[model samples]
Target: MSAARPAGPVGGVTGCVFPPATEARLAPARRIADAVLFEGYVLYPYRASAAKNRLRWQFGVLVPPGYGRDSGEHSHQRTECLLEPRGPGGHLAVELRFLRARRRTVQRAAAPGPDAYLTVPELELSDRVLTPWDEGVPESVRLLLPLERLTRPEGVEHPFLLPARRETEPVTEKGAPVGRLRYATEEVSGVLRLRARELPGPYGALRLTAVVANTGGWTAPPAGADRADALPHSLLSAHLLLALDRGRFLSATDPPRWAAPAVAECAGEHTWPVLADPEGGDDVLLSSPIILEDHPRIAPESPAALYDATEIDEILALRTACLTDREMREARGTDARAGAVVDFAASLPPEVLERLHGAVRSLREVSPVPGAADASGEQPWWDPGADRGVDPARDTVAVGGVAVGAGSRVLLRPGRRRTDAQDLFLDGRTALVEAVLHDVDGSVHLAVTVEDDPGADLWRAQGRFRYFQPDEVTPLEAS
Candidate 1:
């Protein structure tokens, strides 16, 4: 579901445990004058043990790094957030944050340690963001534990940093991004290109594929008079750079080209360039992993807690505090399925895939399953069973409904355990299989299929949980 609150070693120093008077006063970084202050930021869904249990909130939208160190040269961005509020069936929701745990330092790029926070845009903390039964304060638990669709949609891209009007630019090269830039598109053909393969052994570069056309809207009328779903999505997926020491763009098959990138590996040549995030000029705003956190199918207020998950690293440091780039565009036309072909063999040229085909059909469908090999192998991308989940390898997991509340982590379906398949990998793509969650004397029961299969192997209906960690949860490894 996009659960990432692991912001501990980006720059250094996030030691605020909480309780020094809330850091003199406001302190998420002195407010930065008011930063981008979009329009939303509020989370308060309690009931870690019991109060009545309603608690809802699984938000994550960060994009800080307004640019400082030198402004023109310097790689230091800081923006941290963590909400995690799930309770009703999934469980795990205990708030209480007033700020103040000691150790300070804030003038810019702050929050490297002490919960680390160097935010500036729009300045938002939501008072307590979420508080409950606080004696003094420091009870901030949200390290990922209630995933099953809990609101994470805002597609077209733009994870955080919105204010320049909307933000959208920086296709690459503004102050040191390596070089090579220009996506320009009109769908002259298929648009979605990406050529730059560096594969000697461990993959020093790893990136190869082309399906481009134009850049946005203007094509698509063949799938057979298609209209409803209109289908034509394009996504290359590949970004691995955990950032503890060496991180930047990963999706692996043989990563660590001294660069380290092998997060899912559905193939061996994908390439995303850290998402390109985009950059042209106007204002700036970047971050948007996929999209469709939820689209009208409603039905989620809360449902977390399988036995307490431990805050999930503060929710991956609030999902990387947003991403930040600045300069807006909204998402450029939003991508009306006008371009993106991705033909590995349309003869191989015509400018290859036509140049930029709606930015590669708007690119956005790169599956995952490769931390090692086979946490169980197929049938788990959300649980696509009977085959509604699509089936790139097995299926999507179940589609939705067996149990998923919060809003849209992907449509919620949290429940799984038990792995091993060389580790796991998905060179095939497509994921689903969402719940398995066991244990009774303690609480937890959500199965869908697989009445029982160990040596026999039988729990079909689509699968993919990739990486748990109570002892050894691969999540779906294999690249």
Candidate 2:
């Protein structure tokens, strides 16, 4: 189900209090904006080898100019925003920081003279040659002078450069022999800085734009560049740090429902966004977020009194159905963690177990005519009612602990044990029960549409529906 966007600040904060609609809220909004700032932020199942990973680098792609010409457009390397300040008479300061690789160029002399070899007399010395002597020596003479005596009298004396050979080319007995000297080597380091200026406002919002580029001349050129003009390129990771002061930041982004608890906590640290462009691209470079902790495991059962036993069983059953035989084998062959998952999937009832296995095998087959299999005096392959001996007539029908049937409005109970992905987003939420399907086993499942879910149509053109066991919901009494 799609989550309702929260109107106010979304992140939990520590330290100072934030003004209404200010920096506190601004942080989270920025995070949400950053989520799309880079391409391929996340993939389904989120495994490294998942098929969706092939589509990585789908967002925040900053392609070098002319690189993506095949697509008729170049990627944008900059993003800007106009942020409203929470209060009047305050200044705003922003610092945009991102990862930059170190690049340097070395310059060597075009012509180097023969290396000069100098020898020193027996004395400690700090440098090979001592310059600015009280008296200059004739180039014709070789001298071994005391370095310490020249600098300070009475210290441990050291011998300075004693020119061993003065190679001279006599010219007509009139010109002094000329000696060539070597030039010193030099290196230049690359640099990148975020630039912005203070703009005066009549106590309102201010504009902030961040530009990322290859400022250094030594960067490698983008792909498909002409060889003559091939320039160096500099790539940056997506993880950026934007420091702001003076104005209270308000909304930035809302937390994603699919984020694990650990990811959510890191996002709450006032960090803008989490993952970005896990699959790398030369045109679109991104910085990965630092994940300091792992996600907490959802418990198999909860001891809280409000926890629903029937809902737990149903969740376990559905989860088991989702597992493939290959996954079961892998789990069994792997460690305890995999074994636990295998154990859970193995706990489904016999009829449901067979249905799961059949579904896996028939994923590519066309569906048979509705009730055709049943008409043949055989149970439907996908029937959820097969082998159920209980009768619904003798069982009580309930929603949220209240006896309910069609047209009954009930508030979803909060704090239900979330043992499955389907249950996680529904907890503490409300839904309307459009219908109730009773199985031959006397178990009732509510067909509900969450008030907040933004429905979508797949290739089959069927609307997504959410179901819940009666015990998972509680009755909302009249006030």
Candidate 3:
């Protein structure tokens, strides 16, 4: 049976994870789980080729065994997600939904001579295709493709002269055919139903695993099997649908605003923990505190605190600043949906128009330098202008609550462990500030070289000089 849809307003985080093109392994699965919980799971201005997009597949990933292997019997793939319900003891249920690719073997009859008409006597042609899901889970869960007749180049539609046959079987031998199909069957699609069950506990953690296997035995053709070139295995989409008991739970897409203070103070910017099993199992724990309604210290504005009260004003301002008259007119062309979005963006308060322009101007100022530009292009406007010969002794500023300037020594703050290897590792280490630079965002940063290194040269043009934000360093006092 189809699972019931989630009722009432619901809030939760949803994101895409990388699918394993080959066999799903434990290391990659763990990494995927960690990535999904990482901050900035998906960045603004989402594009596939964006720099941020390189960090794709932060969610859980699963792949059938024997995938990407030269020769091996394929086995089922499994994925698990761990969840924690808020508040005291109560029952909880969740619905999982994901996209699975449908596999079908397409065949076309060879061309017959101009004078010849293709005809065949009544004969049975049976073949089995792979079936990925278990039995008793009603078939035809979704119609990704409707059943239709196959057409030839001559525009002749071949009719199914006899009833088609289908059955599910196991893959007892390597490279065995699974789903049975006849000459009349051109293509087919597969469907999956939501699997739900009661959690062991409401307040405690629960693990959910989705297992996919090619239970049917289907052997690919010896040759010319374009569809079978790659193993015909099902895939799961990253979108997950979660349902919580009504009136007993509170959910939000983003962390609450009160979380901001903690986030800022965090040595590393990670706001969520990797939900992996401590015993090296497939399941992982999702580690974010769930706010409860009746908590003694819970504030009424907690729910709305993270949201900007003037979001519409800011968005309207942004629209006016970014879109030209021609572009605005073009946005309304033909497509009613596009026009509606543009109209809504344009309908902002008049009082915020000036502020909107200012915001846009600031955004442009901090935009990244073009690829063709040299290092000088990154220089901020606040740097010394035409009078480039300013006295160094006269320039002094406070960074991270400490006085600093050229020749000043500072200590780097410890940062959390990072997988990207980009984390500044000079934590607690002292360095000499060779220069202080300001960026367009009105933030000060220090360029420093290691104090003890013999080759500590900042002028080599390609030396290991590092820049740190004001908050990431503190001025070292004189001995």
* All candidates: TM-score: 0.15, 0.26, 0.26
Best-to-worst order by TM-score is 2, 3, 1
lDDT value, residue 230 of candidate 1: 14
Q: Which is better, 1 or 3, measured by lDDT?
A: 3
Q: Model 1: residues >4 Å from true position, as ranges?
A: 1-41, 45-195, 201-205, 208-479
Q: Give the alpha-carbon lDDT of every model.
A: 0.21, 0.33, 0.33
Error of 1 at 345 (Å): 53
lDDT agreement of model 1 with the native: 0.21
Whole-model lDDT, candidate 3?
0.33
Which lDDT tens digits does candidate 3 get at residues 1-479? Answer: 00111211122222223223211322333223222222132222222123543333222222233332333432333333333434433232222222222222222222433322223221112222121211101011111111110011222111111112333222222453322212211121222222222234333433333333333223344653322232223223222222222112111222235333332332311122332233333222222211111111212112111111112334433543366554444333212223333454466445534443332223343335332333555544544542354433345567656678778888877445421234355667888877767655766666778788677864435644677765777778632
How many pairs collide in each candidate, listed in order?
A: 157, 32, 22
Model 1 C-alpha lDDT per residue in residues 249-297, reported as the tens digit of each score: 3322233444343333323221221221122111111111222111111
Question: How does candidate 1 fare on TM-score?
Answer: 0.15
**For every candidate structure, what is the RMSD over all alpha carbons to the true structure, in angstroms?**
29.6, 27.3, 21.0
List ranges where model 2 is wrong by over 4 Å: 1-42, 45-50, 66-75, 83-201, 214-241, 249-479
Residues 42-159 of candidate 2: C-alpha lDDT, one tens digit per residue: 2222222335433333322333344334443222344333334344343322222221112111122223344332322111112111111001011111112222222222322111
